[model samples]
Target chain A: MTGPTRPAEAVITGAGLAVAGYAGIADLLGPVPADRDGDPLAGLSRRLGRHKDRATRLALLAGGRALADAGRPADDTPVDTGPEAFDRPGGRTGVVASSNYGNLDTVCGTVDAIDAHTYTGASPMLLPSTASNVVASWIAITYGMRGANLTLCNGATSGLDAVHWACHLVRAGRVDSVLVAGVEPGNDAVTGLAGAPAFDGAAAIVVESARVAAGRGAPVRARVGRYARRADLRDAVAAVAPGPVDLWCEPEDGAAEPPVPARHRLEVGAQLGRRSGALGVLQVAAAVAWFGRHPRSRALATCGRGGEASADAAAALVLAAPEDRS
Target chain B: MPGGIAGRGALASTGRTAEDMFAALCAGRSGVDTPRAFDLTRYRTRHAFEIDDRPPGGGDVPMRATGWLLDAIGAALADAELAPDLGDVPVLIGTTLRELRSAELAWRQHTDFDTDRLHFGHALRERFGATTTYTVTNACAASLYVLGLGLDLIESGAAETVVVAGVDTISESTFGLLDRCYPAPPEALRPFDRHRQGMLQGEGAAAVVLRGTGDARHGLLRAVAVNCDAYHPSAPDVAGIAAAIREGQSRAGAKPSDVDLVFLHGTGTELNDQAEALAMAEVFGDTPPLATAIKCMTGHTAGASGLHSLIAGTDCIRTGAVPAITTLQRPMDEAAGLRLVRDTVSGADIDLVQVHSFGFGGLNAVALLERGR
Candidate 1:
């Protein structure tokens, strides 16, 4: 068997978050009430948000916020300088999103229409939204990201896997940076399938190579450290955390006990709702916030599909605080 | 670059094995027929490339797509002389609609199936002993996208062996959408033809095993490049396709002149064909590489189409025979100067092959494969 290799280090430059009853990532660290909020897509233009579903809209809001936070253009404003116009950062920016139930509402609705009115009754406009990658596609289209675009519909670990693939893209030299978003909506259809109330928001992070972040003068919040996926949770934890950690963002429905001990433990799902696909990104965002308060402290975020069988893969990643606090 | 392809498998209306499928293609056999899986009485045209025979397992499966996927994986493992259980090896799946058809069946017929099956990881873990699995749904280009990820996993030394598969059954909802979008269903799918009509849906699964430190029985994966058009949702972008082709070739350390054959993503749609032709012209200039479209016989397999082309391209390299697009009577005006394969060419000198997959949402992926030494 081939052992896992330590990938090149990437830095998290920006983060965007939207959760019910919470204002920002800082709020996630402490306790918050369970209250509903207004429409997340209230300010988006009708032209851009014409036929989008709830998950897509939430992803757009969070993705646009992250891009803006990174000091990059958030919307698809045409740059008409010359042939080298696309040579800007947007040209090399890619998007990777994770959403297990992103398009369930659209799919169920379309299927219901087919059952009632046959083939002719299905709306052509809503058909494209049924694809699971619609969220990532919309984010790329809105931001004009022409790099490698991907969407992960993997099970519970999808959010962390999306982040892993984003880092993979940067390390492989495929793209300069990647916009990673994890979104899931608690619509009736999704709730029915999940048999539980889902989180109705998105979390996004901008992960770029350290060299690119330095070149572009972007502030590095945290450095992406070792990442590993193993059949067992203990192996994953051991692989990622060879050294001690300051904070551990434990998976909401993960193992009953912590695999690796940390100074402090934070249950993201307890503070926020059961975010499903958005859980991993939210965990990383909380870690970034913690690093901001305590410099040079390391954090480990772990996630997995909980089970006794070894087939239930677990993933873990280390996040180190930036060296220069200034 | 990714590791070599140790084994490959396929399940389509054309055939179950790659050899059988390629033989049917060379003999000019078509798999398109009237739909038998679902009712199509109210539709204007009722035709799809439906598979009649059940997979290796019984037909009484909760999710037909899962059954096909398991069968394909089994076949791939057997071909590679590996065990049925994948153990800790990672499995990467690509599908446009994962168990959505099963959910539709439940909604329509009140069939009882576990909702957790919607996410394929549960079934994959239970049946194949896969510890890590990634499922990607990037429209029709989903399979190639996952294949690219599988390559990265092996190249990065994250795993020694990886299983990559793509499967999509007929989604009644998607079928209905296509029925309303197209003017009328043509008799057959004639991709890249002058009088080609829109494409018909097809259902199937394809899989390949990549091993970093083992004998590559099939061929070597040179490179895979993926990009989003970021343009219109349904329209194919020429720049995106050209960029993917150029990036794939550049990653493989090959020039435009080095490519011997190209498997076009000819979906028999007006916009798709026009855009693909323009992209080829932009990349290869006046005289492009010898090209062929497998959708003429297999129909458009949607998400599984990319792997279908990749497997067929591997077979072409092994046999030195390129199948003909029998449905192509005349090339389109834009592709007139292109060398579209007409008849099956035997003993042809082919070393490097390129495959193209473009899907809705303007997702584009290209892969290059070299002949196994």
Candidate 2:
């Protein structure tokens, strides 16, 4: 594993989060009505339609608040296809968004459609949006970042992975700035399957290279110290015999041990969310919640999801971003 | 000198090694066979080069195709001359399915289950004691993407050595879904041909051992970059392709003027051919470097395509030549402005070749591999 180290260029200038245990997480859940349209065309008015899903609303609210806390524009004018957008303080900004269970409302609606006797009525765009990358796609479209954008889905590691990759992009000079958004919305589909173990919420951080943050006179919120992931879930499960019997036995491989000791010290939610995607989002939200409290504190966050046998993990170290008043 | 093939393993219909697959290609033999993994009764395309089952308990290969990947990884470890104690080695796997078929089969036999229980990443890390690992699942580009990640790990001093592999096997869910999407049954996938209809999905696994500057005896990773189109969901923008090409060439310290051969993505889909051909023509002009497609031999191996092409490029370097684009029967109009490698032989020693992977959600990755000095 690489040592806990921060890249030279990347600095977490601003961080904002909304989680169940954290204050403002519930209010920001917004208003997501059960009966909503599946395929609404993108428009000035339709943009508000996304508010129906608490995830998007919380994402915007938290993201808006983060930008506000950093003294940036409350609403970053969309930087669509122009050198002008890249020239702005956050214009050339790139994004790495994560949602373990991205757009759960879309997933539920799609599943409901598929399960419904009337398959023809199902929305075509629903399936596409239900994909893991949709949140990143939505963010890029919303923010107008034409640079490197990725939505990683590896159980709970989604958020930390996003931040980890963001650090790399900044260090490698891929993007001037990055918006790492870890979002999970309140949806019955997710809550129904695995019960809402962790409160649904969203967290976003504006990251930039130290030089870029200083150049723009932005306040540095935190610094990413190190990041790593151990995907040793295959052996985590007990091995089972082949044929039609013993289907539920975990693999018995000795190497299935987790890289980090089990998280018995932490206070976990009531339910073990079934969806790897959801657990990832919750972990990210939790990390964001933790980071919010300890602005300058060096913190380590790990999010993981295990199957009947397999387990996936993503980990990151968050530290206070150094201040430089030029 | 370019490091010789230090470690290689492959699972295909012929049940062969890296050497065997190469020999088969040289002799003009293909492993394409009848599809037996699922009920293809309702479809017109009932053919696939399938691997027979091997028991899982070190007996017969129970999961014949999937086991091939595990065996290939083992073979790579053996080839690298590394002991079974690979605790320090960082492992990265690229696959779209995540053993989806295995999980699906398990689910069908018994309901209410988490299908990811059979994830390949978990399997490899557990058996090999891999330290750091991640699964890259971006459709067909998964393999190459993982390979690129492995290179990054090595280049950044993340690991002394990185094992990168890509694998996918024929699954009923994928097959049935693709069948429903495009009903051109059992038709051989043909790329850059005007008459090309659609794509045929196939399964296989391949792995490579990438080492940093410390191990000259192993191999050198030239340069690999994963880029996104930032545009549409499925189509590759001309600008995105140009950017990826430029990025690969720049990272490899080669200019467009220095590239020797260009290995096309060639998914055999009509739209893919048009987009890739346009991109190639724009960058390399009329005399684009000797270009060929390998997907014809392997079908659309999805996660395995990127690594498979990388392996093919290595084979090209080792053999002092480029492989032919297996099934391009006719020249399509879209490829008219570009140089297409066809029915020809060349002694042109390609110092640097670019492997292209344009996949789901506009993932356009171009990996540059050179004859390591």
Candidate 1, residues B1-373, lDDT tens digits: the string is 5478998899899998877888897788888888766666757666789777644543223488888888888888889888878766888888898888877666656678666576678777777877677778888998888888888878887778999998888877777788878877677788888888788889888999998635578988888988888777788888788888988898788999999999999988889999999889889997688999999889888888899999999988888889888889988998887789999888988999999998888899999999877
Docking class of 1: medium
Supply DockQ values for each candidate.
0.51, 0.16
**TM-scores, one per candidate:** 0.94, 0.77
* CA lDDT, candidate 1, residue A287: 85
Residue pairs that clash (backbone atoms under 3 angstroms), model 1: none
Model 2 lDDT on a 0 to 1 scale: 0.57
Per-residue lDDT of candidate 1, residues A1-326 (tens digit):
11364444678998877566656677768876566466656655677677888888888877777777777647455342222323456657789999878888888888778768887788988878867789998887787887788888776677888998899898876688999999988788776666676778888999998888889899898888878766666878877764768888887665567676689888885644467778888888888889889897888888774456523577788888897332
- Total backbone collisions for each predicted model: 0, 27
How good is the docking of model 1, as DockQ?
A: 0.51
lDDT of 2 by residue, B1-373 (tens): 1223356666555445766665555444656666765544444566665555533442111243446677778877787787655654766666655544543343233334342333444565456755455554455666776666666666566566778887777654445445544536547777798777777776778888777554533234567766655455455566666666776676777777777777889977877888888878777876677888866666777777777777777667667666666677787987987667665344767667788976665666788777655
